[model samples]
Target: MSNLNLSFACWDYDRIQALTNGTVQAKGIDLNWLNMPVEETFWRMMRHQEFDISELSLSSYLIAKDRGYPNFTAIPVFMSRFFRHSGIYINKHSGIEEAVDLKGKRVGIPEYQLTACLWIRGILHHDYGVHPSEMNWYTGGQEAPGRVEKIKLTLPPDINIQPINDEQTLNQMLESGDIDALIAPRAPSCFLNGSPHVQRLFPDYVSVEKDYYERTGIFPIMHVVAIKDEILEEHPWVATNLYQAFVEAKQKVYDGFNQTAALKVTLPWFVSEWENTRQLMGEDFWPYGLEKNRKTLEAAVTYSYNQGMIKNRLNMEDLFAQSTLEAYTL
Candidate 1:
């Protein structure tokens, strides 16, 4: 039988290099890998369902499914995860020395519904009693102007969110102290360029993030791999095949980290860092399947519902393909 050809759009990550470079192949499928920046891929896929499969925002996917958009369904493969503490930037003159000071402050975000911001808000609310409704929100592009939410949202009345002027960007707003803080996946250029005005809310974010993980066991998932519903309806087996391929691709990266003869990554302390991570997070640190990630998944669902991104708290199982929920044991 001929292999099925499908278009897949995602960012280039070391974990998925095998699949993108054709070293790992999905069973009965041929991937036309479309490597692109995450923002473009997300905008095209969310607005138009442009790809057969793509990496999707976890919060956006939940919102779409809850609203019955019917364009996509996801497998349990998480394409991106990060600790968002480092993403929160604050202006020096804002008088915001801590997370609680964000209450009643003017905070900027690239979008209210971004998965990273969702996690940030949830973490602040839960860990420090700073609720989403406490602050006034400005939304626009981080570096460019006129950016808008990819998915439509009907947030509760208490959450005050507004778009910045079309001519302005969040990075500029944050740098000039027009907004007291910005929460985003990427650090603003102001912070990257070492502007005296911009700084991370948690400057020692590595230590803070480590403490957070030790306390809560959540590594905050940002993105999931989704297949168009049309493709899934036609070939249900595609879900399992793609899921297995992703697992294999990820494992290859994991194995590469152990090659001590020569460093697999460029860092001088790559092996030591890898060992420290394993000591802290265990062997299968970046796991793909559902059961291994239930706590984090459930937390994300809760955050989405509490922040009004979704109408109800979705069951964790409802977020992924049934076929990808289990694996064959040897």
Candidate 2:
């Protein structure tokens, strides 16, 4: 078979790199990983007509879809979940011990409009009965500007999440007991546990989710996968192969492959780092089955619509080109 030239945006996002490993490589589809920062990656993908298969975040997906990159599809490779949101942390000495305790105090978040952060708000208001709008919020998310807007979502009408960004200021405020609690997606700095701090709040789901996750190695939700349109038209089989590779590799990780076996295919990814990253991630972190990712894509579109992130409403059938996945299923 002839080699396929595919455009994949950077490898900094851990899971994207993992997915691109043996899966895409084995199909004679070499990766053109965009080696820039996240913002630059988006712009590069936007300007370059050459992107055959790009790895993008859900927000980035919306942006690309708006700009008319007809081939963009959320592939059915569900490899992440709500773990990357605003984590809720309080000072060790601060008397505020629960999610509800931060009523009229300041909260620090990495960024605004992040999906995981949205999940955090939903959990806080819907699950824990905390009104997000009433509390003061300070954001310290990525310096890359558009990301914050994407992260600052409006929930339940009255709940308007305000944002403030400045890493040093947020850190100083949180440490000085100025911010009563910190609500943000997981950051290396705020991790009391390897996962998000709020996992402590969801007693019922955490254990059940953990047990089932350990049993099946399932990730509950995430941005799913898709092939670039031109590649789907020109080399449909390779796209299907890419999808199959992820499914197979996921099984391989769950089934227990020693260093030599995985490394031969995985190349530079150390088994320890690879294994640890998987263990540190929550069970819902990889929750996409072949058909399930389509559901995630559906949920994502619904969310983008509700959030007013996009002007055009994209149906699943319209957004995803299923020729490759359909053919593979047969």
lDDT of 1 by residue, 203-235 (tens): 999999999999999999999999999999999
| Pairs with steric clashes in candidate 1 | none
Model 1 is weakest, by summed lDDT over 10 consecutive residues, at 321-330
**Cα lDDT listed for each candidate:** 0.92, 0.53
- Candidate 1: residue 330 lDDT (0-100): 18
Residue lDDT tens for model 2, 190-303: 344343322223335446445543553433353444466666666656656776666666655544434455453455767665466567664333544445455445555555
RMSD of each predicted structure: 1.2, 6.6
Clash number for each model: 0, 24
How does model 1 score by TM-score? 0.98
Instruction: Give stretches of model 2 more than 4 Å off.
Output: 10-28, 33-52, 59-71, 82-86, 92-95, 142-168, 188-220, 226-238, 257-287, 293-319, 328-330
